[model samples]
Target: MRPQQGMIPWGPNTTAGGRAGTQGGEGAVELVMVNPTEQAAIPRGGNSLQSQPDGKGHFGGVHGGRFVAETLMPLILELEAAYAKAKADPAFQAELAYYLKDYVGRPSPLWFARRMTEKLGGAKIYLKREELNHTGSHKLNNVMGQILLARRMGRTRIVAETGAGQHGVATATVCALFGLKCVIYMGATDVERQKPNVFRMRLLGAEVVPVTSGAGTLKDAMNDAMRDWVANVADTYMLIGTVAGPHPYPAMVRDFQSVIGEETKAQMQAAEGRLPDVVVAAIGGGSNAMGIFYPFLDDSSVRLIGVEAAGHGLDSGKTAASIERGRPGVLHGNRTYLLQNADGQIEEAHSISAGLDYPGVGPEHSWLHDIGRAEYVGITDGEALEAFTFCTEMEGIIPALESAHAIAHTVKIAPTLPKDALIAVSLSGRGDKDIFTVAEHLGVTL
Candidate 1:
């Protein structure tokens, strides 16, 4: 029997909702009615969560489709093909691995936070130290991979959009390493707040362009970068900073950033003899969270929690909790949950951390949320600030404002769990870039 328009088939006698499925023998057939929206959270063939977005980049048949202009269609297709080819090539893999290890610094440590655990007095906490990587953030993983792909495609110039400027700095650093022209589009507001990173980009020979449109934030910068790419299609590549763009980009960026999750898995096994009970990471465009969550998708025992920036409070008009307060909409060439008004117009998102100040989230995150494969929560700016101070004082590790959001959520839940429970938080970046912002918020003269 054909299921309803919004419904799908599930295994017999199983729960009727979520992307739940069971492995079956060859030619085995069983059907139970389920809402299509809730189906396929875990892929069917072998229950592997990684087997997603078959071909067209749509996660769970709802989010993520190529919604770009005709002028960019051919280029998008070319990029999709190039990425697929490169992903399968052993030579490409070896080269990327070499650069990641020798230059970008792979296998960042997973430190057990003894003080944090003692303070919480509940779950044992582990910090995935991506902040120690070159450029001081996980952004370098995607940037390095994309820049290498750009070179393979014979592109001599690279364009990127950044919010907190970590991505811009990473892109600029790689461009300088490879002698390619680099151009970064950052929001005017971000340019002012992240002046140090802006200077670093310029020093590395990148042209930093301040985008003044649309609240002067990451969304505006992305808009400008897309325009630049459309105009300079030839000899230019757009290295999207996060996994929130058109086809291949969301998937491609996730694959590159997956290194974090992959390494964390191995490290956790070696340290604790098993997978973590929960994984936590902050979500701006959700690259870091997706990176760590992707590897654990199949591990049903591990809970994945994504913390979105709640600028003021979740109910406050000023906030960046897209998944918590958004509806599905197409933005920046992909269909995802966006903070929009009743008229379907995108709303301005506010966050103390510039990196999380975007109106939409990656489509995969939306799909995961719908399928109940992951859980997302909001951390208010005040909560994050408190966590920041606590982490610095207790652990002596100053985390980036983006990572502070995750820490805030961890702080909330750690005390409630059992002592043996383990939680791993992705310390995505260092706090050096955010000291000024923190000081200003604390009413201190820096």
Candidate 2:
């Protein structure tokens, strides 16, 4: 069968060594999925999606790269080298593992949502309980890894950007644990809406700086953090919260967050004796989605779905569904799908969930979308809110608004699939930080 536009033409039974034909004669490489025990057996340069970007950071031949100011090149290069060294060192791995298991509470449970599954009445639903992490989100996974790397590099100060404040909170928590100075740049709007998280950051000894530029959201916060990094390259390490940045960051953060996927794979096998039928996650900068999607990339039988926040609707000119309604463009240092206009001006994205309010998605996600390795869909704010309430009532779980987007999509598709279909959704964070925002939307004053 011919491949559809923007999708790779690989059949379900395609093996690891299979080559898929793409449009315009661009050859596509198929990824090989391996069992957890055999992961080390795969060759370093094999045809796996995990070993992507080809040393230049460009995924699928085009989606990622270091498009940063020349001033930051030295620092970026230094970070890349340090991270590479740390990755290869067993000592660094052991340190990071200790912190993750003891402090951050990793290997979060894979919960079977019996109530939600019965309510949906089709697919069996399993929620990857990232919310159970110490910082109340999967943000801790990446933050812990980066903070340890920063310590290894002898950086005494750490800077970061946040939208929903989960990343900010997680970064601050780690910095506090290590006694490093922390500075979090948050959009003014986010700072206002996510006051609880802002307070949490402050309590954790992080100085929160509010950026008032560009709709006062994640993109603006990232811009300010990058500026701060450029000015203080001597002692400051920029702890990026997501997977949308330059070369080493996109790959580095993915490596750190891949633990989520790895755990899910093993846990799913233990629970069901096989891989899950579908893996679902919400996409903001696409970290959580990438974290959960990376391990299963080569498993042709397992479907990967990423749900983007559609603030109003896909066509309403105000949505964060970058992969769905956007074109490829450069933003936040990487070439990816962005919500831009006719003149290529970056458009402000809209979403009730601050985390998913960015105008661009991760470059890896763009590559995956182009190659049909995964599917992305948009969930409107209303739908997410509904799911938020439904999940709370049905599963007794309060999912962060960001994760509610994934749950909303699951609510839609679960009923359509067969009863035995297994679906795993990344509950990336708790709803505690989103209570104020949700209250206001529901016309309740708290």
Backbone collision count in every prediction? 1, 0
Q: Each model's C-alpha lDDT?
A: 0.86, 0.85
lDDT (10s digit) by residue, model 1, range 140-179: 9999889889999999999999999999999999999999
Q: List the residue pairs that clash in candidate 1.
A: 19-41
Query: What's each prediction's TM-score?
Result: 0.91, 0.92
Which pairs clash (backbone N, Cα, C closer than 3 Å) in model 2? none
Per-residue lDDT of candidate 2, residues 1-446 (tens digit)? 11134443222321222111111111212212212223333343355665576566777667778999998988888988898777766677778778888898776888999999998899999999999999899999899889989998999999999998999999999998989999999999999988889999999999999999888989999999999999999999999989889978988888788888877877777777778999999999999999888878877899999999989999999899999999998887889999999899999999999999999999889888988889999999999999999999998999999999999999999999999999999999999888888999999999
